[model samples]
Target: MADHVRTVLGPVAPDALGRTSIHEHLLTLLDHVAYTPVETPEGRELGEQPVSLATRWYVRQQWVGVRDNLRLDSEAVATAEVARFRAAGGGAIADPTTDGIARDPAALARISRATGVHVVMGAGYYVHRSHPEWLEAASEEEIAERIVRDLQEGAAGTPVRAGFIGEVGCSWPMTDRERKSLRAAGRAQRATGAPLMVHPGRHPDAPAEIVRELDAVGADLSRTTIAHTERTLPSPAAIVELARTGVRPSIDCFGLETAYYPLAPFVRMPNDGGRLAIVEALLDAGLGERTLIAQDICQKHRLTAYGGHGYDHLIRDIPVMLEAAGRGDAVEQLLVANPAAWLAW
Candidate 1:
């Protein structure tokens, strides 16, 4: 690991991390989601539907209470949220809120102190949709300099170097600008010796190509993880190939079914099973040690009335699913061993 980076959880020596969710947004401002408009006419129409009085009242109450109380800028609230996670038995959480979306590093430090939970913060820029326009015009070397600065100098001037590289990639097809940004991100990773956590494109090949790109830039694949792979149902062979090459393939999406509530008019159940099937197949392929699971739960509404899925889900529900699948040890690997090793850098 580089001198600038420090794990908020202190030393994540082997077996020190217990129950970690590698991909999650602890406190997103919801600004990024706003940039990507609904493309289809029907989608836009649905989005514009007038809120029912009941729904309106609910939204208002949530906004007044939870949303207002949990703003990432508030150090006190961030500390409280970390306490909540610890109370629920979580040991560590990787907050992949990078660059523009990421908030104060001092706030993270305070939260770590208050809650006694290890927090690994991120250092790269976000995708094109979320990034500022100036970023798109910058040269790869310039972008790489910014990322390196974050890792070398603590983010927002905090003393801790960012513990990880991304949520760097985006969901859309890789554009020339995105490719340039990725190359820059890779260069930063190489310079800092920090692991890269990519937000792979929605396609399966996206991760494979990303790994290749990182390798070309001389980044260490053994320390990198391709995240949000839940949508990319890559073949088991392909997944194994990534693992063999030293990249950890993260299937982080777990409880996002609510996002598709009421379902699109054309979508159906069989397709819903696709994500779960990928999880099963990956486990069957013996990729358990290289896999990490998380809810990627970010929206303010997804958290309980008090706070987001809080922490009980990881301590309880996830273990139940693992047991049911006859892969109980796999859960330990993800929540404990894998993160410790990967984050140890």
Candidate 2:
């Protein structure tokens, strides 16, 4: 058996994990379902919800796409979706919803067993807003020790150990709390030998700052992946610069093409076509081997159950896209070899 990756089902050889989705959310429970819909990319109505129960129910019903649309709680639904990925020849997924997002390790284990997809769970706290109150009082060493336990033992008092250290949440102008989490995550990464996946705040400069902080903590750059460059850093040159640092830059938003979030001024969301141009730039910069890709499917609209492009969108569509663009040779590295190398222990 391959010892490169430890799936929820158990350890597997690297070659067994064919066409892995490096960063995705097979399940996400944002503290028992909560979200404030933005009227526009500017988030014009930035206020608190009414305290009345009737108004809360009314908001949830009215804002279907914006609110209460993220709860992927049905195991049967999740199982069917993973079956779709398997039908498309996908063999694994890296689910990065950690404590802040109600990560269900047991559910992940069930889904992996039912669907036969190698599911790799993540370990670490998320963004400042998603952190549990106890995390604020915990020291960096304490948090790092907890992650080590999650990796070496199991997570959420279950027997499913995490295979990676992220997607550690960070925003533009990293907060002190996020910085502390990053330091703790870096230390845990060193201790456990699991690769790190990062979610940079939707800013072009956020990844660079993340690299600086992780470096200060003695984290290995080569084992770190900066995710969502397609949404955050729109500039190919900027993506290339991060790749040059010996860190992997994940252009993982393959099918997402919207400006629904309030990130217009900071980032103009790119479609798959636009992301292709960025990938071309990385290849030209001789950083192809350091790049990774995924769909980052956190919302309901992005899933096949909801009519959006499923997890197989990239695996099925990108090859035709690459062959049409004269970049067919780049497919294997992005889809197979790189993820296998990055995810392997």
Candidate 3:
């Protein structure tokens, strides 16, 4: 009578989803979209130094460059990462790397098998910059059909189909093609009842714009997640307003404490404590059921293999923080039940 949560290991009852991390990237090529934080509303100068110098010194090393942000292809590494999550009592992970960003469904299936953790792959296009050569020429119907096929059939010739439509990347001022892709993703979500997780550009207001556009196309906001709100929607009130609209405001990006814009002229990254505070605020606002969290581990630097905080951050760190903040029950709803319900039909 109830919908199952489709995973790489096959569909399972929603209760079967234990502690779930609603967003992540187990594998990906760094070519999806070039994020220019300086161009964002949050961007600011590092100091008196010119932005060009800060851009050249820091941004180039951190976020840009294909080699630095190259594809994380080691199954052994992914296995180790997933193992940490599992050991920390993690139940499942949703990998939202779509077409443009280098999605490997078969490999994801292999990782799921290797680690025995449920994996959900994302379908649909990323930002227009890294889109396939034919995406611009393709009709919205054609794009939607491709994504639907990926969700229902298989992605990249693998029998393993995607369980979700996105972490569909969109910029602040949405592009024409980006809007088209969002609409197509909405069409696929309507067809599959799978959630659409979006990566709104690094601005607090970006989520509202994205929701407005997605709503215009008749998307089920309850089935949509506006991601990276830890950085985008700075205040709990801002996030609560978005969640009140019926869409989930995902407070992903845990343990990534490095100020993304290390220097002036780039948007900054908040620490984990700040994120926990926001979580407390959301719970206080009584929107705990409408929110979720994840690591958004996209780079080697974010992985344990590279001496970073692995998948255990949220599972290990947050519960203490949550209970200390007095919302212990909120953790279960955010990481487990909310993800299952959002991903299920």
Candidate 3 per-residue lDDT, tens place, 1-345, comes to 578777987888888879888887898876335433344433433321222432334433444432344456677888889989998998899999888788888888888888888998899988768688887888888988998998888888888888888978787677888888888888788777778988887677788888888887778899999888867866777788888889888888787776664322256667888787777777788887887888888866667766677887888888888888777878788878888888887
Top-down TM-score ranking: 2, 3, 1
lDDT tens per residue, model 1, 134-250: 786799899888888876676666677678888786655787777888888899888877878888766656787888888899888877888766556345455656676678877
Ranking by lDDT: 2, 3, 1
lDDT value, candidate 1, whole model: 0.64
Which of 2 and 3 is ahead in lDDT? 2
Error of 3 at 43 (Å): 19
Candidate maximizing TM-score: 2
Off by over 4 Å in 2: 1-3, 31-34, 39-65, 259-265
Model 2 pairs whose backbones collide: 2-13, 252-294
How many pairs of residues collide in model 3? Answer: 6
Local error of candidate 3 at 141, Å?
A: 1.4
Point out the worst 10-residue segment of candidate 2 by lDDT.
42-51
Off by over 4 Å in 3: 35-66, 262-266
The 0-to-1 C-alpha lDDT of every candidate, in the order given, reads 0.64, 0.81, 0.78
The number of clashing residue pairs in each candidate reads 2, 2, 6
Give TM per candidate.
0.79, 0.90, 0.88
